[model samples]
Target: MLKRAFLPPADALVAFEAAARHESFTRAAEELHLTQGAVSKQIRHLEQRLGVALFSRVRQRVLLTDAGRLYLHEVRGALDHLHDATRQVMSFAGSQDVLNLAVLPTFGTRWLAPRLADFLRQTPQAALNISIRLRPFDFELEPFDGAIHHGDPIWAGGIVEPLFPEETIVVCSRPFRDRHLLAGPADLLRVPRLQLATRPMAWRDWFEAKGLVTDTAFQGPRFEQFGMIAEAAAHHLGVAIMPVFFVEDELASGRLVKLFDGTVEERSAYHFVYPENRALRPVVSAFRRWLTAEARSARLSRESLLPG
Candidate 1:
């Protein structure tokens, strides 16, 4: 007969449960809003604590060995019980189970909007409401379960969870393309530059990167929302500086095209940010879990496209 097993830390237990259920560390990482290394580390700790190998590592994936499967049966029951007990207490304490979402306009439209259907399907019991706001770290002064913002999580006194990283690129419409002969980033000088009101430093950085200096980077219509900027570019107003990932559908649909691919600048990472006390709520936890998974899926999908 097996001896009673030691209880691992709650977080490691949660990660192990997710990984086991999905049978994929990468998937579990996404769902848990953790790095793959973090998830693996959690499982490692759990395995060491229990003195048994739970996962059989095959070439590119993990499979549940007998030990893993048996442990899962027990861990899963505990997780379900914990989840149930938490939910019962929450329900007894409150009636509104709504999830408030704060989003940047551009990303909301181009990236998250497309994937909204999936989330709604999965979490239909919860109300999903979104508020559009400017980026650069503002989680307070608004009622939201969570917000998606660009740039580094440099804000003080807030909790931030990584969703994914984004790179900005230069793009234009076909009409705006011929307005100037383009050979490189320097060619942007002759084109009308669309700007994000928040990132005034973008033009300076782009020029500095190319060893070129032109005042034209600062000489375009400034807009706050990426949706507006994209619209302006689509109408041949000017070349828009935006995230390539955000505009994937538009690019594929011929609404936009890259003027050049040379400078893929790491502008900011997408982070799910909320108030410092956000971890205390289960709705926030669910949102974090779901967002983490989405980011992971995107990363894997991108990786699969590379020439390996």
Candidate 2:
């Protein structure tokens, strides 16, 4: 048999959190619809359990002790998480499952957002809640069923499923390309080259792929996101290396033009990642199958578009 965990009573925790927030037992009691004495009793019980004085009682007011302040921060976070989890469950009404996902900002907007309608249509029983997360995080701490990951497949304790490899190409404003007379990769050296801060070696790799070695690969105005870099390049700031999937709108609308005929495939790829424990979940499995199929179709379409 499993040993019982040492946890304070839920009602006491709730009372303590409320009391700590307002720093007044009367105010907390009013908010919780309890008498001031009842709120004080709950807090007193909590203090006894923890073996620490939570508040410093002055003439007629109460202030959090250092320990109380620290505990309040943690308790508040736990309460907020619990509230959110409860709300999420309640919101699921009749849905079979709700998949909470963490997605990269740009990827979420450009790629995943566009395809979500299809997923919704295909899996009518499931609902999705997406939040932007720039980097990988511990699944145990975060309230997420899965995450869309880019780069290496190195999420510890996660089941990483490859979505697609990223293919990037050189792009610039029409005038920027024409003004510089960039007929080949070497011509790019004369013009300003924009850089994505995340991929420092992108230009270097592209140049090396074309049999050219230069010190200028790392030189340029760096932006944190590809969207910013693409916008800068569109305004003739400089040529930017961007994923083909991201700049379809710009390329189609004539705002940005590809400078080269070929693309540089990154060593990394996009992945659908979830904790190993979720592998057997029906919702997770359904979404994975849908996503991987979509990825495969996208890859085939891209391949067909490439020059043979």
Candidate 3:
């Protein structure tokens, strides 16, 4: 026979436990909304099933026997565990499909923000939550379903889906460009060039990519965030290197002007990364499909608008 089959009925165990706590059959019946005889009969039935005397009639009150005391300890723990398990299952049922994502702060605001409405409209059933994450984080330790990684496609412990290559251009206020009398990429070395604290070698890389040599490539006022650097450049404080899409608004409004003939492609590209061994969640899959399609369409549209 199955082990569960040997267990007594839950109702009888509950009745006996109530009567044992109160030490009075009448009090137990009042709590249970039954007659005193009903509580007494349940205790008797439980005792007969277990083949042991579970209670003793003493001084017109009910007292637990040695066997009843031991059984009560185990039954109380079992019932509490069952109640907790049920509650947890119900909570999971309500929120099992919510997708949690970690993203870079600037990327989330500039690139992803404007495009998010399309994804939401396309996949209305999918619920997504985004949190700022600057660098790669441990999936085992963090409560994230996936992440937007700005660098290489190789995440140590996750699967990577390619997003796009980083295309950067030098930009500054229109007045700065005219005042400096810049003729070529080489002329930039003489002016106050801005630098990203995260990419100290950006100026040097851009210069070298144009086959120019200069010792002043590393010298500049470094800023931690791209937004701050872009703002500084827009106000004619210095010239800054920025991604094309990031400064599209500034360029369109004539606040910032792009210099040079081409963009400098960063070594690492953007990617969507997630734990390799994680079970595929419905909401996450829906988001991935929508986001990739949006990215592709945006790229094509931008390329078509560029002058040949």
Candidate 4:
């Protein structure tokens, strides 16, 4: 067990953080609305508590020692977390529970945001705070109650509920398609191919699904987000392999055209993930139920659209 005695005072931590950030006790004191001597005293006390020299006093200037630099990184994170917790508690209203969620950027904008009105309608007492997180993070460190996770169900210390599988298809601007005279999957090889940085093997997988192989399957300008790839493809930059759900607007508006009839199923699917201890929370349970039903409906709708 960690000893409370090992912990420095919160005020001291704040003083240390401000001083380290500005490299000036006077600046830190000004920010904290305290005297320079008081800020210096707090830093000295903190250094004594931790048994380390945090800063070196130079002629009319202060510089962080090696230990101070390392401690600053951890201190900032702790202070930010404390601030978030304090804000959350202060914002609590009668009979209303706050649910913090992290979601992938493109997925959150296209899929989740559109359906959130329904969730809010169903749970009038629930308040949502959503943030974007592209990859998996520790639930303990982050303030989120749950996250919309893609790729796999491998979040440690969290319960993973399957949502829906991703179906990817090749798309390009209608003009590009007509200009290139694309008739089959093989014709895509002659044109520029845009790649998703996160899914480096997307194009390679698409070709493999069609029983084709090529050395240049991985070539193209790479983008970090699906939205970027879609935009680039829509402007006739290059052909892109996009998730069908994400490009529905583009396809419907004829901004981008599907190159073929078939869709490639990615190896991983989306999932609703939360810490195991939160499983019984009413807000969590309600959200999981709503999200599961929405995913099921979407799946059925998608399946109905597929040609037999």
Candidate 5:
């Protein structure tokens, strides 16, 4: 005996999901390489089988009904889980480790990219897939295996491995610094300070740490990402407070200069975060070992550069 109540025809469900996602039978048909009539028929059959209207037609636009919206959420999760399970089984059969990792944009570009070659060389049996993500996402719905989070390890359902604390230094174009005398931290208040939207209080924190205060610390042109701020600072638009490792290339080429003599430690630090359940995977363990070691090595290097 088979349980008909528990199983929907996979083909019909796929067609329904695609149509619901696009909200247009024509678009879904094009995506699935089927005729519009066939797509419509599948949705009609699915609605009938479920004993409800999945969608409502208002003129030419198709909108999901309340029931349809709820069903779509569950359907998407099931589909994603099935796909992940299939891939996991394939990886296991082949004895290969596949990791879907998300990274912060600027850190991925300036810091991790240069070191990934070594990671690949040391972990040849593993295949690392990288994607750019700035914030935490749901592991139950999202496909990411882990992420490099640039903040405190406070995310629920994840185990955090501390990488390194972030230390920022103020930097500006050399030409801009040459034109103005910035002999002390107080002089920084006179110039236009570029700011990061993510770190709204960066300048305030840095200034207060140096025993100075200013009203204009929060006043500046704001950028959404670190890379944009770096580019703006390099062009002499304004000064920026950024991680030393992030602006190393600009400093080496003489395009940018550090404005102060001391570094400010930020409250948040970089960390490698993964789901607690997946911590035992061989691939996860390998990456944890390699990246933790790399972060430790980098900390030593950063400490040596700062004045004793």
Candidate 6:
């Protein structure tokens, strides 16, 4: 009977928990990094196997009455117990808990990956699962311990800690900048602007911040990501408003040069966001401390250069 009880795949239970917590599969999907269809299917499969309906759907929203609430109560406890047991067993081999991180793709690849060697050295035997998240996701609904997010936007239900602040500066290939005879800021008007779809208004914001609100901000070909935009700029296809932190190597190598003498803060800063409820987790707390230390160190260096 016990074996039969535990026979069902753990994924079904996970799906149910996620759905019950968020009351919206879409949000759960974002958190779990699973498709909406997949989440719903998992829940449905679990319900069929258990022979009990878990969620009561109403008008495109799910409501948890007695059954779901009770089930969640028990399931949460069970899951916690299971996790504890797993950790206890795995702890013997030092293959215990994992720290799952979801970060912006470009930032993770260009910045975080390099630092991971040091991180691993410090936290020996700790496994790190770094996943790329190009958009905002539901941390509560997902299994991520934490995430590195872009933008200076406020986090409503999660903890938002700054990893760094950034400024968007106009950059283009050296040859392109010179061949176009781009003498300064005003010269940008005659060049092609490479835009990031996520921040379609980045050019506008930067221009406005620099007191150059021209119609050109809205007239660029949009790319889905910063990496693509950067690549196009590296190839001298056009001028790109790129975050300085992301293109440091290119700039240092003189492959990509700042087009203007000035830059702008689109009010967008990078943050380390996670469930506020997760602060109690030891791994979460440790990573936060370590990350903040790095961020503060960098901030201090940047501040040292300022006329403050």
Give each model a TM-score. Answer: 0.62, 0.72, 0.67, 0.82, 0.73, 0.66
Q: How many backbone clashes does candidate 4 have?
A: 0
Tens-place lDDT per residue, model 2, 44-139, is: 989998999999998667899999999989888989989987887786888888899999888888878999999989889998888889899999
Whose lDDT is greatest here? 4
Model 4 over residues 81-191: C-alpha lDDT tens digits? 899778777766664788889999999988899999999999999988888999999998887889999987899989999998888888999999999999998998899
Across residues 137-256, which tens digit of lDDT does each residue of candidate 3 receive? 889887788999997677778888888888888899999999998768878888999988888888888888889999999898888878889899998988898987788888878898
Predicted candidate 5 versus true structure: per-residue lDDT over 172-268, tens digit per residue: 8988888778777888889989999988988898889889978889999999988999999999899999997898888777778888677877888
Candidate-wise lDDT, in order = 0.77, 0.87, 0.82, 0.90, 0.86, 0.79
Candidate 3 stretches with Cα past 4 Å from truth are: 1-96, 304-308
Best by TM-score: 4
Tens digits of per-residue lDDT, candidate 6, 1-308, equal 88888566888788788888889988888889999999999988877887888888998888786877888998889899899667644644655557878988888877778777876677676777776788788876677778898876666678888877786678889899889999866777788889788877777766676578697687877888778888899998999988766777788777788765555655668899988888788778878888888777765664333221
- Give residue 86's lDDT in candidate 4 (0 to 100): 82
Task: Tell me the tens digit of each residue's lDDT in model 1 across 1-308.
Answer: 13344457899888888888888899999998999999999899889888899999987788988999898898889889888557645643433567777788777877788888887677766666676777544556655657887788765656788887776678888767876666677777777788888888887787888799776668888987788888888888978777767666667778887776443647578888877777778777777888889988886675333211
All candidates in order of lDDT, best leading:
4, 2, 5, 3, 6, 1
Better of 2 and 4 by lDDT: 4
Clashing pairs in 4: none
Residue 172 miss distance in model 5 (angstroms):
2.5
Error of 5 at 151 (Å): 4.6
Error of 4 at 54 (Å): 2.1
Candidates' RMSD to native: 20.1, 4.7, 14.2, 3.4, 4.6, 11.0
